[model samples]
Target: MHDSCSSPQTCTKEQVVASAAPERTRPEEGHPLLEPVSAGEVRAEHVLRDTFGFAAFRPWQEEAIEAVLHGPGRVLVVAPTGGGKSLTYQVPALCLEGTTIVISPLVALMEDQCRALAARGIPATFLASTIEQGERNERERGLLAGAYKLVYLAPERLASEWLVNQLARIDVSLLAIDEAHCIAHWGHDFRPDYLRIGDLVARLKPKRVLACTATATPDVRREILERLGFTQGDYAEVLRGFARPNLHLHALRLQPCDQIADAQVVRAEV
Candidate 1:
């Protein structure tokens, strides 16, 4: 149960990177009713129709959303980079009664996600190193006061006494681990903080849990499940494909080149 933000973090505060809504905004003044769909419905009709303005669900979003809304929930989505992993938990959080605690690997992702959720009329916030102790305390207090539906935090946040205490007081619906591959030592950017996740998740007592990753091989996927201690029957890996005919897999030794040109070249290719 997690959301993502899109700011590239620099071991510090996350920055905004989207078209933002005004602070403290709520559902529009007037709209047609978008009633609850079912007991298994994750995103309420209003979330799709009013908040996000999406008329229909995409691919497995509806199925994944339903799975989360139901109990005994754990999902592992191995979708590619653009498959909308964040929506799986965001929709469920919207339908649930409490917050979704998102475990993130990057500060920028948290900022981007929080901004998007905020714009969608979901009270979302983030915890980063930039805030002063006083402001940090205040934000924590405010969030625990039940003003927010989602909280974006780095995996390291779980190590803090303040975060632990604040989390204990809040009602959390889901615990979503984004870039879940980071939990593995074999991962390109292994993070020690990520290894502490399953324990932290048990402490939060969330109703559901979701671990997401954009790129994972068979071994990486197995390692991810083991790191999370997700039993064999506890989760499923939904893989779309492993082939990209357009890509030429090759290693190249390179010397430094113009940074701006390199970026421009890559962008043009995409």
Candidate 2:
């Protein structure tokens, strides 16, 4: 994985891993992370420390979190992999009043994040086809009861009228769209179900929405904003530079027949 340092603070890979570890005690009802700040107030640093056990924010993470927590509430975050893009919304999710709905494209990614949050003593769950109906029902009950801070679902799951109706009943504090580039037709990865997310937002009327992606060009970003029903000046945008000094790229030119010989020679040398 590539290491990214967009902020002047310079965060190391060790620091990032250490922050994500579930070593800190979970924030309780009286903890600072659980305390609600007034409108236009920013308590992200508190959440970063008390919940994630991080000493600082990476690049635009704090700004993005503040936007969702106190600003326009519509945000688009474009940061490279390992740039703490998840924390932009996750931090705000902890401070918000209701459950945060995350629409992710990959089940494994959702499962991994849910597990990580659970390990940190944060309530999180996901809806996936691999789960049995009994478990799904139980999870749904938990969702309605506000037993979770974050609830993940696949983009395709929004197509279900029953599920959408059920979500409408709950107070959705935030709606986060992971891999948001999929909403753009010209993007490298496009999912048709993502196109319906704007409709879902209108139907559910979540108080806030955040779209995050690791790769998106200027045009693709504009398309994503449009797809999510965001007009110019209606949303906040946080973009971290994509320069990875620690990651290097090299290219070698060889004929098709020479490829195996080159690999074998390299392996022998190693």
Q: Assess candidate 1 and give its lDDT.
A: 0.67
Q: After superposition, how far is residue 121 of candidate 1 from its true place, in Å?
A: 1.8
Give candidate 1's root-mean-square deviation (CA, Å).
13.8
Error (Å) of candidate 2 at residue 1 is 33
lDDT of 1 by residue, 119-194 (tens): 7778998887766778777778777898888888888888887678778788876788899989888788788888
lDDT of 2 by residue, 1-270 (tens): 113444442232323443321123132311112122476543778878988899999657877876677545667888888878889878888887789999999999999999999988999999987789999999999999999999999988888898899899998888999999999998999999999898997677665789999998889988988878655223567777667888776667879999999989877965
Worst 10 residues of 1 by lDDT: 6-15
Mark the regions of model 2 whose C-alpha exceeds 4 Å error after superposition: 1-42, 250-270
TM-score of 2: 0.78
Clashes of each: 8, 0
In candidate 1, clashing pairs total: 8
TM-score of 1: 0.72
Give all TM-scores, in the order shown.
0.72, 0.78
